[model samples]
Target chain A: MAFFAAVNNWLKHFAYELQGEFLLALKTIAAVFRRPFYLPEILEQMHIIGVGSLYLVILTGIFAGQGFALAFSVELADFGAKNYLGRIMAIAIIRELGPVLTGLMVAARVAAGITAEIGSMKSSNQLDAMVAFGIDPIKKLAVPRLIALIIMLPVLTIICDFISLAGSWVIAKYIAHVTTTVYLSAVRDRLIFGNLFIGLLKPVVFSFIIAFISCYKGFTSGGGTKGVGRATTESVVISSITILVVNFFITKIVFSQLKGWL
Target chain B: MIELRHIHFSYTDKPILKDVSFVVEDNESLVIMGPSGSGKSTILRLILGLEQPQQGELIIDGDNICTMKEKNKRKLRKKIGMVFQAGALFDSLSVGENVGYYLLEHTNMTLKNVSEKVVQMLGFVGLDAEEIIDTLPDELSGGMRRRVAIGRALLSTNPMIMLYDEPTTGLDPKATENVLNLIMKLHQEKTIASIMVTHEIIDALRVANRFIVIWAGEIAFDGTLEQLRSSDDPRVKEFLRPFLSSFTEVVQKRFVEGIATENNSASL
Candidate 1:
């Protein structure tokens, strides 16, 4: 009986937290359409999340792309299909690697940053102070981050895809002994509309996941400095896992919708 | 006016305020005194509509905020200003920006006009606005931060009442005197009522017109200064014992000064 009671309490608490998270995300989306847009805050967040994550995203793209080309070249060479390296790299990187890698990296970097900044604000009474001053914290703080992430995540994904393709081209020419012209043509051939759409779509979905989880963790943070640290870590972990899990579902949906197109 | 009638508040399974009730009439200076975790600050948060009570009504100026919508509560908030412990200034903003935050965000006042108003408020709080306007909050001393917070509170169009939570807990003697004097001056000049929550008996005695003592989530005593001084309640006595020596010293010093004045006048 004691065991059953404990399990029931845990289930109830979990359901409560799940409901809170959904409400927070919905309020944030509704806030985006509300008045008092806070345009300057939105622009500042765009600069931070977009410009701040550029170098890291670029580095991740280059290395992942080069490693994929190097590894796949061996397998293709075994089958005397080395010229297909470009086509394989392009499809993998554009439809999968580029968006997922960018999403995870951003989940680590931007999500942690957003959570820490907001958690500190919460711990310090700024959120209450904002309310006391008749300002909505969601409108003032969360909306800018959500809007900025939505705009910048897709842009970052595109940049990552192009950089990754560039990195693979280098490996195909120098390391794989595949002719540059053949590899380039093979990559161009795989750059169909379906792959491009999926690549862009994934990051947009990932953006909402990262923003909602991080902002929710932040606004709910308590205790103090230790609580802020705990929330930041939780934000990153939740966002990264959600992105990976959601990526698979998004891919499944896209594959079904664009059946046989590739 | 503010009133809390039979308010009951709880967090988790533990009650923080149990059947607590009080009132502060217009232009009244009411000091809430209690030990740590005695639900003193909780009362202030409840009055601010930051937390809801499990049962009872919190009426501010005639409206029962417990039943009001969030939008109306926010509109009502403009009538009150709060000063948090640690100052709670926006760390990212400069002193001037922090002081002028409300006017800048809520009004159509241009930066130039807001800057002027901020400068005026800084002077009102006895800070050098010109010298410190551009400095971040972290750069200021503890006393300066508290003063900036006061300035921010007063800068609201016209706050009918001010709520201060431990405003001088960590300040030095000089800073404490400055802050106490500032509170007194606001009472005299602006005629704004105030509710101050503090454990500092000396500061409370200096500023309060009446006192409400809370013990363990319940109101133990409520009365004027003389009533409190003459009370035989052991809980009140126990709460006052540690600080009675310092309080006695202040009274003794004033007595000596009064005698000196009498003697000097007789000699003349």
Candidate 2:
């Protein structure tokens, strides 16, 4: 009987948390269509999430690209397949590593900040004040962040993809001794429009996941200062895990359906 | 007009309010007093539709908010505003922006018009508008933040009902007088209906027409001033006995200051 009671309590708590997240997401969607869209707020979040993460995103892309080219081109040289290094590097960065790495890096950067900001607001009763003013927190706060993430993540990935290709070119030529012209021509030849489209599309979904999860954690925060710290940590971990999981399924679905495009 | 009927609320296994029933009419001030965690603040949250009771009906202006839909509840919320314990001003916004936020978001007011209204409201709160308009909320002292919060909520052209959660809990004596005086002045002008939740008995005795003291999630005492002064209930007296000496001294000084503050209302 005690075991059954314990299970009942656990199930109830789980259901409540899940229901809260679902309600938050649904309310944000409704808030989007309501009057008084906060355009200034949306623009502010865009600058913070997109521009603030630029330096880190660029550095991560460059390092990933350089490392991939050096690691594989060395092995492929023994088989005289080093000429295909540019094509492989381009495909890997554009299709897989670029979106996943960028998503994770942003999860680290923005998700933690979102959770920390919102959680402190909760602790200080600012969220309650917003609600009392007839301003829905989901609409005024979460929707702006969600919209910013969805708009910015794809733009960042496209930039990262090109920068990563550039890094790979430099590594291939200087370290692997591949001709710059041959590397550039091979990448241009192998790349298809469909792959680029699908690669960029992945970040849109990943970013939505990051924004919602972080905002949800923040809204649910309580206890006090320690609670805010915990929310920040949990937001990053949850976003990172979800991004990786979603990336795999997206990769499988898009690549499988569009095999002929490649 | 707000009424709470046999409301039951709890967080986890800890009960907050049990069978709490009360009614507040327009142009009335209801002060809820109790020890910390006696659920004084919860009453305001219930009224604002920020939290729903586990059981019972909360009717505001004839609408049963506990049974209402979320959309309808939010619609009802436009008639009310809350002042939090720590002011709860947006840290990212300037003092003027904080005051002008609701207008800027909900109205067709131009930026220049909003700025004017903000300045006017800040002056109403006895603040120097131009000096503080562009300053961040964090830059202000505790007393200033609370005054700015009041200025933010009290100046709307529409009638507003206000819920204050410990509005003067941690203020200096002078700031407390100013805030309490501001509340009285606002009340006198019929600018807003008020329900203030505080543990400060002097504030309750001075400002409230009706008072309710909660002890252990139940209303232990509910009475007018005369009834409160004469009540024999040990629980009620225990809460009041220690403050009897200081209450009169504090009230006299503050009441004098309050009258002086009212004379300055014309400047607003």
Clash count, candidate 1: 0
The residue ranges of model 2 lying beyond 4 angstroms of the native Cα positions read A1-19, B248-268
lDDT of 2: 0.87
> Per-residue lDDT tens digits of candidate 2, residues B1-268?
9989999999888899999998888888889988888898998889988888999999999999998888798788878877888899989889988899888777888999989888988988889998999999999888899999988877542445888889998999899888998888888876568999999998777778788989888998887766776778888888787898876576567668777889889677
Residue A2 lDDT in model 2? 100
Give me the TM-scores for chain A across all models, comma-separated.
0.96, 0.93
Q: What is the C-alpha lDDT of each candidate?
A: 0.92, 0.87
Which candidate has the top score in DockQ? 1
Per-residue lDDT of B227 in model 1:
81
DockQ of each: 0.71, 0.59
Candidate 1: which stretches are off by over 4 Å?
Answer: A1-10, B251-268
lDDT of model 1 at position B157: 42
Candidate 1: lDDT of A178?
88
